[model samples]
Target chain A: MIFRALIPAFMFAILIVFFWTGLSLDPSKVPSPLIGKPVPAFELPRLSVPEQTLSSEQLQGQVSLFNVWATWCVGCRQEHDMLLAIADENLVPIYGLNYKDEREAALRWLRELGDPYAATAVDADGRVSIDWGVYGAPETFLIDRDGIVRYKHIGPLSAEDWENELRPRIQSLLDNST
Target chain B: MRVLLAALMLLPLAVVAIDQDPPMADPQLQARYEKLSNELRCLVCQNQSIADSTAPLADDLRQQVREMLIAGRSDNEILDYMVERYGDFVRYRPAFNDRTWLLWVGPFAVIAIALVIGVRVVRRGMGEVESD
Candidate 1:
């Protein structure tokens, strides 16, 4: 009789635990499928010099960062200072994927703000961005020496994010690649 | 002039159609495009399918679906293309894969558990009444 009485309490406890787990999950931070996969092949025009093209080949030889940014996205602006600071360290080359903005406005943004990227690729129609699985602006991908995407950071990256999450991943990649 | 004014401005005319591209020439292909767009979820606007979303990413995805249909790509191939890039989250109706088998089975399992519990509870109640 006493054992049967505890059943309701057990079920209630399970329900409470289930709902509590749901509360902590961030729905927007969907895990990327390309985590262990090679970076998707793409060839897009360079943002600075449109006549020239930037291809995935450039990322092949070194561990680097691929940052997707646009002139219109506020998050990209928020992360720009961190990107500039990271660029100064020269820890890894940062290649920018300038998503869907006009050439002139993007060029002006780089000029006025500061160019943190070693090369900026212009994805005008967003076809290349689709291949990269970029859902929003300010998403960053960490690529290793062989051009495999090691890590993906969604939203604007913070200093804490770099130090805590990304730097460790990059360190492991560097340690393993050698 | 008044009629022109009424037609252009005074009438409560709300044009929701913003697609500049003409409809696909092939009706069969057009149907496929429509079905696929409605099935694919817009990652930006989590609730709406790509067909219903006004987001630019949704527009680009819709264009991709239409173009793939016109290019003679199978529906499965088109879906695979999306799943490869965006993962299974792009599908509103997730596939019955190893990861999602639990999701598909979970509701039925809960019902089965409820039935067992209900039967046991009722039997126990009857036993208590008999003892009284």
Candidate 2:
């Protein structure tokens, strides 16, 4: 009789676990399907030099971070100094995908704030951004030397995120380098 | 007086024209475009469908759908393309697959469990009272 009565309690405990896990998860962070997939092929004009393009070919042959940002996106500004600091660390090259911003504004942001990107691609119409599944600014994709995307970080990258989430992934990817 | 009346009559038509998005030439393709838009979720505004959302990303996706339809892509092809880039989260009605199989089957499982419990409860109640 006690065992039978305790069954409901066990079920409730299971339900609580499920609910707690679900509640703790950030709904805004949609898992990227592009994980372990090749970075989308795109060739867009560079923000600094519109004549010459920054293509996906450039990102290959090294582990790098492809960061999507726009001057209008406040989060990009929030993470800008940290990005500069990360570049200073010299662990990996940081590439910028300047999404749908005026060339003048983007150039000015880079000129003023300090350029952290090895090469910045200008996605003027956001078609390239869409191809990369970029719905918001300041999303970062970590790509391997083989050009496969290993991890995607949504929103601003903090020092804590870098220390805990990114450093370990970079280390593992570096370890596996052939 | 006649000119003023004519201008006034045309004002609403002009407003309506300006208010409307330019409809695609082919009605069939236009229908497909609308269908795809409603099916797609706007990632920026998570709750609203791309069709309903005024978010810039939604507008871009809607335009993209129209272009893809015009380019002779099938509905499934367009959906697959979106799913490839944005993942299944872009689909308002998520497809049944490895990640979402439980989501698809869960309600039915709950119903089956409820039925079993209900049947057991009825049987026990019937045991207490004589069955007609």
Candidate 3:
């Protein structure tokens, strides 16, 4: 009799636990389906010099970071210093996908701040970004030596995020490739 | 003459305010495009479907669906393409699978349990009345 009465309470407790666990998780961090798949093919003009095109073929032969950012995105500015620092260390080549921003504004932003990217591509219509399944600005993908995307980080990356998650992943990929 | 001039002045403003792109050439294809767009969730907006969302990402996805349709892809192929890229989260009505089994079955299970409990409680109350 007691066990029968406790059943509803037990079920209610379990439901509460599930709801609590679900609520605690960050909703912004949606897992990318492109992980372990080859980087989507794209041919975009260089942000610095529009006449010269930068294609996905160039991304082959080395582990690299492809960062989708825009001059208008506030989060891109937040993560800019970390990107600059990453570039300084020369750990991996950082390629920028300048997503749907005016040429003058993007150029000025990079000029005023610093150019962290080895080569920045202009995704004028955001077609390439769509191919990469980029829902918003300031998303980063880590591609391996063979051009397979290994990791995807959404939102502005912090210094702690770099040290703990990104750096170690890059190091492990580098170690395995050689 | 003054009213005509005012109407002309308002024309450009009206054009600028109307945001949606013109409908596609093929009516059948356009119908399919609209249906699929309504079904797919806007990742940026979360709540609104791609057809209703004004987000740039939603616009891109809509354009992608149109292109795929033009390329002679079927509705299932287009849906598969989106699901492959964005995961099951892009679908407003998620498929029944391992991850979604509880979501599909939980409501029915709850109802069944409630019915069982109600029967037991009613039977106990009936017994008490008979004893009285």
Highest DockQ: give the candidate number. Answer: 1
Better of 2 and 3 by TM-score: 2
Global fold similarity of model 1 (TM-score): 0.91
**Chain A vs. true chain A, TM-score per candidate?**
0.94, 0.97, 0.93
Q: Return the lDDT, model 1, position B132.
A: 100
Model 2: residues >4 Å from true position, as ranges?
B1-20
- Residue pairs clashing in model 2 are none
TM-score of 2: 0.92
Candidate 3 local lDDT, A1-178, one digit each (tens): 9997998899899989999999988776778889999999999999998999899999999999999999999999999999999999999999999999999999999999999999999999988887788887799999999999999999998999899889999999999968
Question: What value does the lDDT take at residue A52 in candidate 3?
Answer: 99
Report the Cα lDDT for residue A154, model 2. Answer: 98
Q: After superposition, how far is residue B79 of candidate 2 from its true place, in Å?
A: 0.7
> Candidate 1's residue-wise lDDT over B1-132, tens digit each?
888987889455676554556788988888888899899989988888998888999999999998888788999999999998898989987889997888889999999999998999999999999999
RMSD to the hidden true structure, all candidates = 4.0, 4.8, 5.2
Supply candidate 3's per-residue lDDT for B73.
Answer: 100
Per-residue alpha-carbon lDDT of candidate 3 for residues B1-132, written as tens digits (9 for 90 to 100):
999999999998775421277888999999998899999989898888998888888888888899999999999999988887887788887788888789889999999998998999999999999999
Candidate 1, number of clashes:
0
lDDT (0 to 1) per candidate: 0.91, 0.91, 0.91
